[model samples]
Target: MSHATRTRPARTSASARRTHTELLSVYLNDHLAGATAGTDRARYLARSCRGTDLGPTLEAIAGEIAKDRRSLTDLLRRLHIPARRYKVYAGWTAEKLGRLKANGRLVRRSPLSTVVELEMLRAGVTGKIACWEALRQLAESDERLDPAVLDDLLHRGHRQLHALEELHREQTAVTFHASGPQAPTPASRGTGAR
Candidate 1:
């Protein structure tokens, strides 16, 4: 809202929190799913949080906007994943983030390599763990499994994070512009010289 608020930073070691922060960026962009949003980079940036770590700061920002986790997470159900700001990812441990990046778990060229797929795998892993535990409890003969609640939890973890996927498309579309070599500049095309 103000310059002072914009400059605020959360207090933690540069090394320790950077990974988590980048992880948060990955998570957020994943949550937004990278639709055109409102055509405002400022709006697309989202997360006008107060504290450090874009995650908590996002929560903080939501608070300023009169929204909390329950409210935001609720909206999360329908929103496309958000785009990760490369600058934020820059702060993380290079090796681990590189693994994440190169693995295409954060960003990638192919559809299968995107983070959403990884998160879905993670979700499936979590679901299997829970399903195993639920089966174990079922075997115990004391409790009954509610298919509805179990399905909800399973879906939460297994949900596809489409942010990176959308970002991939959005970025590829830009490559044809004057910025990247995918397209030629006016001078190179001889259009500007005439």
Candidate 2:
């Protein structure tokens, strides 16, 4: 082979670049949908737990999750990716439907609700962490992605996960180890009922 031929750099076709961007658009939109659900769930959980021992931490987490969703939206705009409103609406609807699950209570909030919601929030945060890590990797090649922003997001996600794990452990212990079904106190009565 000629030296020039061997030394020449390979080129990617325009179609290949378009395909890559299209795949990335799909992936990010999916994450945005999940983030929408997560934000809604976090806000709902925080409101339910208001005035409880976990209230402040949950409120903080809800705010952070909302901010993260905004960041994801901004990223989508920067990449010229359109937000799929249908996916966002589906996510919102799914979270609302999730509330109808049987939590062993009909007219009141159960301790099991806290445990289950915390578990769900933790899982969502874990997924967010994974998305941030994927973006961090992509930032190495994609000029539109900022490594600094991705790193900040990753750090916040890990912190959120740690807080959630602690809450989940405490709630699980309190919910499962009780001697029997304790009646709600007057102060607790009707507080979290939705």
Tens-place lDDT per residue, model 2, 1-194, is: 68667555434456678898899888888888899999999999999999998999999999999999999999999889999999899889989999998699998999899899999999999999998998899899889999999999999999999999999888888788959798898989889958
Largest TM-score belongs to which candidate? 2
lDDT of 1 at 194: 46
The segments of candidate 1 whose C-alpha lies over 4 angstroms from its true place after superposition are: 1-146, 157-159, 162-164, 171-194
Compared with the true structure, all predictions reach lDDT values of 0.35, 0.92
Full-model lDDT, candidate 1: 0.35
What would the TM-scores of all predictions be?
0.22, 0.85
RMSD of every candidate to native, in Å, equals: 20.2, 8.7
* CA shift of 139, model 1, Å: 9.9
State which candidate has the highest lDDT: 2
| For model 1, the run of ten residues with the poorest summed lDDT | 35-44
